[model samples]
Target: MSFAPYNDLRRHCAALGFGNQWTEAACALGNERFAACPHGDYPRWKAALDGLPAVPPAFRMREGMPCLGEDFQDQQGLADELMTFHPWRKGPLQLAGVTIDTEWRSDWKWSRIAPHIDLSAQRVLDIGCGNGYFGWRMLDAGAELVIGVDPTWVFVMQWLACRHFAGDLANFVLPQGIEDLPEQEVAFDSVFSMGVLYHRRDPAHHLARLHSLLKPGGTLVLETLVLPDDQADGVLVPEGRYARMRNVWAVPGCERLLRWVAEAGFSNAQIVDVNQTTVEEQRSTPWMTFESLDKTLDPQDSARTIEGHPAPRRAVLIARSA
Candidate 1:
């Protein structure tokens, strides 16, 4: 565990809310806590903080929602909020036998899928990478180079951490989307996308773009919210004077999606994981309160359904480019 002198120290101090006056007092306390703790991850560090009744003023109150802060009300806003969380920093800090540093809520999803990845010698890409969490993990997992592309400034936070700790932002790129990627045809050996497909208005088009970026025989790791049955067509959130027009395209089924991936030039498409847990399963964090959000699928029904109800289940897929 080699630590960078001032740069890494400054970023960590800022993140922990020590600010510019991170003197011996703060450093001593932080170093003591860091040395005493067995797990060096975010959740564990947070748990340690929980035990300490006194916290720095910066972290004393909940700044905003976890990933999606108060500043984020829309998709773009959500992206910006994610940046503030600084997920990459969590990678250096591990906890509870798993790393919880990625932008996604479910760390288990990554654990289940990571084994199948041949990242040691591959060039990887993570699309819609919120704060480049998974991308950072991929780098840690031994990918020669990992590129995370997102439109949000939150990625800048991750970039800052990468530069400060890792000394370069080589593996991450903050492009608006695939269209904006520099001229590098079929460059990546593997591409990973989690929790992004369903948000797109045109899933097929997005798949095509992903296919275009991959080399022949490249692998694409995709995870998204899947509907229970095929009856649920995509939901359209109409544009308002203030609200951005967006569409929530739910996953119909694995077969249909695999076919689309094949059409996009990917073969060997397979679903790797399915999590049916409801929103209630989500832990109460400062970022967002899942319990407060109405989990009822029926518009008229007020009662919250815990089990055996219509809820978005996440599905992970691994596909190989033809």
Candidate 2:
């Protein structure tokens, strides 16, 4: 793994005068964890990046969100190289002339949450930020810096490959999780935990940790799978899997989640939006060749999962640390 980018990040933090425990911990974690993890695809991804044709030092969020191709290189070859890192879950990234139509239209989710937040000049932390796709959008929206953390090494490689094309900036994704974050680091202006809460076996504990990571009065943006209004008082602990995802632990109602937020000591917790995920939002594409939302839902009834649980509905909630 290249520690050059991590070194650059350290320099960037120093230039910004951000000498906090979070910065120190992040730099340490990035250096240690990323170098130690020996993912099977790491070398391949690195080789692809090394072989990538040089592009102009420019990237913009126009056309679609966070696109590359200003310098324009071997279009088909670059696309083929990018395909080696398959099963793309987050974005619809456009290379020089090829468009990687990813499984999830993440831009829609961003649209739902972006209008409600004040991101300009904020130092943000995005948990479970797959490939740092949203981090680029956050930077484009005027955020000062975005610290994205995810434990998946494959996703980290994908983000690195993307960074090769997008050029260096303030966005940095550490190959770590929320648990890897240092406790008592209250430096961020905002923290986002999208599609992460339900995966937690202990939602309250997770919420408390999120609260602890933020400064007093810092904003928290949380998005997660949810139950509908009828099940507002109930929390669905799936017997096995929900929507073919084995990690799903708790699917709570919006009100129940708000209560969890309040119990975690966040103020003014409210649900901003609720949208049922459709095939249009999440489906199989060439870039991501796997069973998707369509296959996860009941063929007989789209309103239920294959396991006979409620269909997938996601909610966005915003709160402030007290």
Candidate 3:
């Protein structure tokens, strides 16, 4: 898989001069890790990328969706080629006149958080960035550069698909996780960790790492599943699967989460928006033909998961590092 956009990102940082040494190092490591990747589907994803017809990289963002390429001949063929990489989880993206109505209405997610943060000329690190969907919104919000890390090779391929049409935009979604990247304490002006907290065994530790990644007085935008304060324990350590997700460990109450954030050395931690996820927000579409949120909910009680846990209610917290 040719990670040309990532390489272009490295070059862009290098051209900016000596201050971006750490970024350069991370970029190099990303390249190395990507090359050494053992994912079984990497070749398939790469082949899909190879199959993308080169219409001019006439990309733009409209209403938060990353629109890729101009309308060309063989529109149905382009859509079919895109369908090769099935289960597109993070988008409702536009590609060569094909509107891929993806599983998640990611534009809504971006809309929720975009109003709370100012990314103008900021350097950002997005952990678990899922095909870098939010990276486009971050750049659109005036972020100077956005580096996103995700472990899934498929999402990286999705990002590559966008890159093929968009050329080298400042947003780069590296095929690596936050844990895999080289350490650069205080490297970012703003850090975002959305929908990734509960998956970790140590929520506080994860917050701490997010704290450490930011510059002095830098912003931390954290979003994760939360149990309602009045309805559950301080932290709900799911005895079994929550919402059909086996990896989910702890989902904190509003107060408990804020306390954890404060304990992790973030100050002025405040909930910006809290919303119970609806089926419309995440459901199966033609582009992502698989079980989705609709299947995760309890049939008898939509407000509860199949395992009887409270249905997904996510909270967005904005705080600052000392």
User: Which one is best on TM-score?
Assistant: 2
lDDT of 1 by residue, 87-112 (tens): 33222222111123332244455577
Model 3: per-residue lDDT, tens digit, 110-190? 889888889988889999998888888888789888889998878888888877877777888887777777765446889
For candidate 1, which ten residues in a row score worst on lDDT?
A: 55-64
lDDT for every model? 0.51, 0.85, 0.85
TM-score for each candidate, following the candidate numbering: 0.59, 0.96, 0.95
Which regions of candidate 1 are displaced past 4 Å?
1-104, 229-246, 277-284, 287-309
* Candidate 2 per-residue lDDT over residues 57-87, each given as its tens digit: 5667765468865646577788898887787
Clashes of 2: 0
Name the lDDT value of residue 115 in candidate 1. 76
* Model 1 TM-score, all chains together: 0.59
How far in Å is the alpha carbon of 288 misplaced in model 3?
1.1
Name the lDDT value of residue 8 in candidate 1.
38
